[model samples]
Target: MSEHVDVLIVGAGLSGIGAACQLRAGHPGRSVAVLEARDVSGGTWDLFRYPGVRSDSDMFTFGYRWRPWPSETALADGPLILDYLRTVAEERGVDRLIRYRHRVVSAAWDSATARWSVVVDHDGVESTITCDLLWGCTGYYDYERGHRPEFPGEESFAGQVVHPQFWPEDLDHTGLDVVVIGSGATAVTLVPALAEKARHVTMLQRTPTYIIPQPDRDPLAVALRRLPERVRYPVVRWANVLKLVANYQLAQRFPAQARKLVRRLAEKSLPSDTSYDEHFQPPYDPWDQRLCVVPDGDLFRALREGGASVVTDSIETFTPGGIRTTSGRELAADLVITATGLELKLFGGIEITVDGEPLVASETMAYKGLMLSGVPNFVFTIGYTNASWTLKADLVGDYVVRLLDFMDARGLRTVVPVREDAVGERPFMDLQSGYIQRAVAWLPRQGDRAPWQLKQNYFVDVRTIRRGEIDDDVLAFT
Candidate 1:
């Protein structure tokens, strides 16, 4: 049997749930169905179960605008966040609209009918859903698995191997010496948390990241749980935004000051004799790549308390017993946790096509970081790579709802992009950051224009997305 809906949402993550909530509220008579690939709907939060799994950004701006978080802590762990998402879905009636364990395998658009034919796998059976509009919120994280570095003789090493995404539920680390690979956020987070249970936790990193330790608490959030939303929401949100902007400004305009402070912290955190010049300093400027934040000097405190530590050396290979470092040290480990970072998957592995022809992501330009050129009725919410992801995500959501309302009022059934000849010919992707550069080949590019280019500035995004006219000729109305 087949089902039909006014709108079909893929992946019931933050974006999907947010889209559903707004769609239902705006058009009360419309039927919207969200299909989640996994049985659970927390997306990234539900998938990553490593110890001390938390957000780098404060939950104040990271949380939904409609429902403010009561926690004072800026850094929220996985369980709390997962619980928050579940609560939002349930409270907003989004849970009822979700079809759990339904994975969308393929979606083919019929240009003649102007509707999407979506194929989903449900409980070992394939079913189809037809919808006038399709919303994708699959998120950037690949659910298939995370990126694991291939170590020489890793399979032969007898130690239990684990990744943060697929952490063993029953694996007991008590009294075991553990070695975690990589120096990204995941690696830094695991060191502090695992040190509590493991005999020793060694973090191996080839290059050091710009690390800044900050107070993870939010004072406004602490005072707001007792107050009503009308009185508290704006104050807290604005305050967080101010701080993010100020810090970002410092990193952008006065890079030296930020670098000096980071250097000072590293010097104070590490041993006096330890080479602050060598092990602590990064090759690039601060914030050139993503700067990792540690709470309460957790990693430093763990190192002090446990006497277990950080080693800056490339992994030479895996020995029969453990890992062999480039420093010619063989580190013995009872368990190995590969905290090596994630692999980027564009649009959650969905193959996008327009008007019965395939759409090449690299060929298209990014439209205000939310929409892409040549893609119609599609608004993707990707937040600032440097700042809090949710701050921009919230704005993007508001803009999308407003755009939809504008279309419906005018009795428009379709919205398609008008490809400007000049914008399409320009080179789109150019960022020096390793993460962005690594996946540049796969990511959708952008051109130099009002709607085609991506401006990282929040103020610019606000002017463009929120206040912009909906009836512009570039965005064709049908």
Candidate 2:
């Protein structure tokens, strides 16, 4: 027998739990169920077990708007974020809505009944659920595995090889010479953390990333601790929000100036002997890829203390002792960490078919960055890459609640975006990153015009998603 619900949320992560809470409060008449493939909540936070794993962005804006973050620390640790998520779930009764170990295999939309037949697999048994609306809050990355490229002669390496995504809890880096490959956020974060106990640490990269210094704690939050959470949280949150917005916009508007400014900041933070042009300079403009934030210049401090070093070169092959770069330089290592990148996947890699037809993601255009063209009663939650993720997520939650309320008032059972034939196609994600580039063919397309384009700006999203009218001619309702 198939269980029935008004909404079926696929994932009990940060976004999924938030969705459930909003639906329960906003539209209390509806029945909701959150399907979590893993046994735990707090998706990414619970999965990543590496040392010093923390928020890349400040926690104030990253935290949900409904529940103000209590931490004065701007960049919260992974365990703290997990606790926050689980706490929110428990307090809001969202934990009761989650069905753990329920991996949704496929969703089929029945046009006659206007309901989704969702097939899920759990512990070698398959079950089904019917819902009026199906939400894909599973995030864009493949949790089953991360992006791992085959390095030349990596098998010959005498040391242990580790990927930051699937980091083993038992694997210790104490008194070891570690070489971490890649110049992404993960690599930068791991460098200093590994340097704490490791004999030596080296961040090996083909190109340098834009590294900016951020404070570990928010001084404003600490100062205003005497006030209640409702009073002080918003004050600190907006301050950080404006700061991030200004940084991103400045970088985008004046690339050269921003580039020089960032390099100068890094130079001031790094050791005097560290060559800025050779090691700190990047070839591309800022914000092309996401910037890496180091709290209180921890990465730079490690470099100054001679605990960690940065190397800019290509990896030719892995030697018995370590790795050999294209420049014929060998990096001695006892443990090699491959902080390559993430693998992008849509809707938890679940198969979607509408009226017996397979839904090709690449062919569809996103509707206001929430729903897809020609897909009915379905929405996916994807956060901003430039700013804090939850900033955009909270806005999306508000828009969804409004949408459902609008539907209920009109007695509408189905809502789908009618794609404009005249619109030009672009990649869903505007970033020029390796992971996004690899998943181009698998992801959906965006448009060049309004309501179809995926705006990375948080303020623009607030105006459109938060306060904008929902009943535009672009969406078809039945």
Candidate 3:
């Protein structure tokens, strides 16, 4: 491979791969290289292997733009998603540009040279590469660590403890009493799958999360069958956006009303004996924390079917046989699956420096949720907070190509967000999700208006990013 390239993408995941495809399709002869941290591609899909793992969103829009999901169902399992990503990478010829097992350690921008010097560790040896543009598609997934809570006597407990993030391939669960801790998407997915195979599955959650039940068969299945790829894809995509927007608007304007409607929906799918207010009702407002969607209430069905059960209590400590609850109950478990949420890391834990000045994530302002203040010739893709991740990511990819195309036409080599002293009134993350709240200290903060604000709304993003002027006053060009 060449030592230098026009663009150096720092991930091989969905967004990164999508960016590569966009760049290739727009500018066919441009030299681009994708540096992946792991040995294989498929970022989230490759990392997660827990049972019942699938896209919470419909796969119709979740799959790549160039590729159509072959599954009859719109929501697919992990392996199928990985295969789709691999297919897209191969078909688009982006796989050849990826250098696996190369983790970017640090990137420094040189003002004089108008290039970025990126240091990466391949296998064990470290090397430096220079590029005109540094595009970070390293997604928000916690690659560095998993967020597992510390229980008293955790080390002393004799039971095997495993996290779903790093599930062992050869591990056996037959006849084992499995205790899953947490109530997020991961926990919900794991509990139902393990309950079927294990002796018993217990879900211990401290707080209840709003759960919405979806149909077993994907809603998009009919569309895929009746509509052509050209019509089906856009229809599904817009439908997803409309649904997401309606949900968001409901959550924002009338949270209580929305919650009641959602609770009623859940109750309709659940057993008659199920208590919606106690088991399903969330403390926070709807969309304050993300409402997890269950595929046909499988998790609820698993609980109702008797192999699985829910324990709405805090874990006091780890006992010899299982977990000891704060309510003075001891749950027996041969295996413990910590389905706790992921640990968030910024820029894939890589240090960013601007002209030898160390750049902290919190100090940098986001420009169109892509470029950072005081960072030049760099573009990163951060998707929607409430909807399908790919909706915004795909738009960002198209925007990046457009921006680059504009630069080419104008004979511009450098693009950077000009820093200012003004502060913003709005919070960086307006939502109250645990993942966002927990990582607020480590996350990037936004400012008042353009270049610093992050609009989670898809329509605003599409207009500002896709059709807006790339060479604006806020973004300095040379």
Candidate of highest lDDT: 2
What lDDT does the true structure give each of the candidates? 0.78, 0.92, 0.83
TM-score, predicted candidate 3 vs. hidden true structure = 0.96
For residues 231-260, write the lDDT of model 3, one tens digit per residue. Answer: 777676677668888888878899889988
What 10-residue stretch in candidate 1 is worst by lDDT? 425-434
TM-score for predicted model 1 compared with the true structure:
0.94
Q: Which regions in candidate 2 have their CA more than 4 angstroms from the true location?
A: none
lDDT of 1 by residue, 235-347 (tens): 88878878877777787888888889888876677655556667668887777778788887788777777546888999888876789998899898989988877777777
True lDDT of residue 39, candidate 3: 91
Model 3: ten consecutive residues of lowest lDDT: 422-431
lDDT tens per residue, model 2, 188-207: 88999999999999999999
Query: Cα RMSDs of all predictions?
Result: 2.2, 0.9, 1.7
Report lDDT (Cα) of residue 255, candidate 3.
86
Question: Model 1, 76: alpha-carbon shift in Å?
Answer: 1.0
Model 1 clash count equals 1
Q: Order of candidates by lDDT, top first? A: 2, 3, 1
lDDT for residue 165 in candidate 3, whole number 0-100: 86
Q: What is the lDDT of residue 28 in candidate 2?
A: 84
